[model samples]
Target: MVSHDPAPADPLSLHGVVPPTVTAFHDDESLDEETTAAHARFVVDRGVHGVFPLGTNGEFPLLSDDERDRVVEAVVDEVGGEVPVIAGVGAPSTHRTIARAEHAASVGADGIVVVTPYYYPLDGRAALDHYRAVADAVSLPLYIYHIPSKTGNELSLSTLSELAAIDAVAGVKDSSKNVPWLAQAIDGHPELTFLAGSDSLVFTGLEIGCSGAVSAVANAFPELVVDCYEAYADGDEERARELQSTMFEVRDAFKAGGAYMSGVKTALRLREFDAGPLRSPLRLKDEEATAELRDRLESIDDLEW
Candidate 1:
């Protein structure tokens, strides 16, 4: 196993609104590189601190290896170094995960977002070892992705601390949504950075020392999300809370739909972005639901694409 310790040079700390990009698909659900690159550039142009492609919000699991590489390359080339692009590089298998990480590095990704190995339950030691192997395999900075609800394996605080000690493990995306644990993680490792994995928790996360969030809601409303962070950063608690409350309606609307990717795609289409639809087995939101989403968004006039 690789040793976890501070690297000789600390990687860039993840801060502000980093939207986990949604993959653009054609009507037949084939990868749409042009639309994908356009969406990526759209977010960057709207002023998010960074763009994270192929994350859970990006439907990472649905994408094949080649598709993943193409999307990452498209985003990298489009952004052209305007902002950091952290490519998702997680797989149920360690070797495959490492290969994805290496690919991200080779393609000039700023960093990698790696989730704990899923499909099998893993204890702390196993989790530690898995991440260590991946970290050892690549030299680029890594942000540990901890979403226990989806993976069925929670990254305990001890595991996070252990990973934080790794030279290449720069930070973590704590999707736990457990506020107490988030606070504990922040207090325990003041030196390590954390990004909230949920939209509802972004403000609270920042209040408790988390750097920022990789928000799903940011995909639909980039400006509002960025405003919340800027408001909190400037210590305008009331304004931040107000903006956050407005986003709650949209966030809840996303949850009401069976699958959020479809809702997001529909919303993008509503905005004339042509994000297409979700792949098989994931149906688009019903017309009624899409109408509700449109109504909810209409109230928030400041929201940008």
Candidate 2:
């Protein structure tokens, strides 16, 4: 297994709580660059280790090409030096993913997270060639985003091993939520940095040797996840487990009334941070559901929000 020592020259060596930050929009649903940048700054200020824009939580697929580039630019401009900005540049097509990755690199992103090409069933060879082309398109480190649940495409172990062999393919963000699969992948490829892509699996992923997490929950409660990660990193396993339980509590509370996608933004608004509304087809929980969410959150003695 690779040592946990920091690799100054390797962007994939990034660890700790990296929030897949939410993209902000005005009431009219227009991009709000100022609020978007502000959210990045807020997370960094709260001691998050890195910032990721244009991921599932960021509503990447809902955005246009120009808007995607703008989000990366806004985030990088706001917190590029403060923390690594690993922008999500994946698309359903190889060339499109490459274009987005190139744009992210140009805007000063530290690395790129490429979700598997979705909507089409891809065999191993197609997946391999797609990633290879995208990796070759830019000098930035490439991280495979494995969220088969949404993409309807899963990378087999053999395929993951092959992807790990690419010089530019540096890591993975696993939202598969399959512990066995993640464990085997991490064991088979120690050289590649592994990040837990789900808030529900952050601690479990760390237990299996993930370097860190790309948490959706961290978008609103960065410090909560950060504290959990730090507890583990500091060799306080008991504390880490306690924090993990707290994280699950928050996760459950957020998911109350089916607020999975809209919870983070709503939490941000409740905390007085402007995380504007989610785009079409994804609306906030209704008032009754939201009130239940608020009550649940307030019941958590440790969480200030």
Candidate 3:
């Protein structure tokens, strides 16, 4: 097996609330590196344990190679030492994914999250080979990004078992929303760190032994998730559930109009941190819908945003 010295703290030990941050863009739909880095600082300051740039929340599929690279560099430059920066380097092909992974490493990302190759169906052996190739190319810890709904490729437990044997394969960020699958994966490989990738499952994941979460809701309201995590870690399950309830309210408000992604950026704006617009083919809510969202969020008494 290939091995390399772990970066900073062992990334395998990565825990607590980590936000898959938004890719801030200017009004003209240009990459706003300044606000992008600023958003990372925002979450880190709010007590997020780590930051993940260029994931689904980041609109990774919408960016060019250069734009993605710059986002990673900008984030690392802003908060490299404060918390681990796990950059999303997944692409649709193994060769391209390895190239992006290499760039993330070169620019100082502590680790990389490689989603399974999307748009094409593949079996377990091919999936295993793809990850092995990427792991071989990068020394940083590699996290499998499993969101089958978006990617259309679900990882089998047998493949996950084989992946656990690769020294460079550190963990998984599972957005599969399959609680049983996640539970089995955690039971099946105690060596691999498991992060709940959905905001809905943060508390449930902790209860089931996940080390932490990669929360999209955290991009806007990190403190809520952070408090939920701390409460659980501190052995206050009741407190954690209370906070998770508030989080669910916040999540509902954000998803109120089915523009959940837009809702996250909108919530950020309401809190006075303009992450600006999302990239093209994706959009902000229309005026009336946005206003309704604002009213709905403000009604949540426990949250300020």
Per-residue error for 90 in candidate 1, Å, reads 0.4
How accurate locally, in lDDT, is each candidate? 0.82, 0.87, 0.88
**Candidate 1 lDDT, tens digit per residue, 60-119?**
888899999999999999995888899999999888899899999998999999988888
lDDT for position 141 in model 1? 86
Clash count per candidate = 4, 0, 0
Give the per-residue lDDT of model 3 (tens digit) for 65-111.
Answer: 99999999999999998899999999989999999999999989999
Report the C-alpha lDDT of model 2 over 9-117, residue by residue, as the tens digit.
3565789888988999998899999999999999999989998899898999999999999999999999998889999999999888999999998889999999999
Error of 2 at 235 (Å): 0.6
Q: What is the Å distance of residue 110 in model 2 from its true position?
A: 0.6
lDDT for 112 in candidate 3 is 96
TM-score of each: 0.94, 0.96, 0.96
RMSD of each: 4.1, 1.7, 3.9
- lDDT against true structure, model 2: 0.87
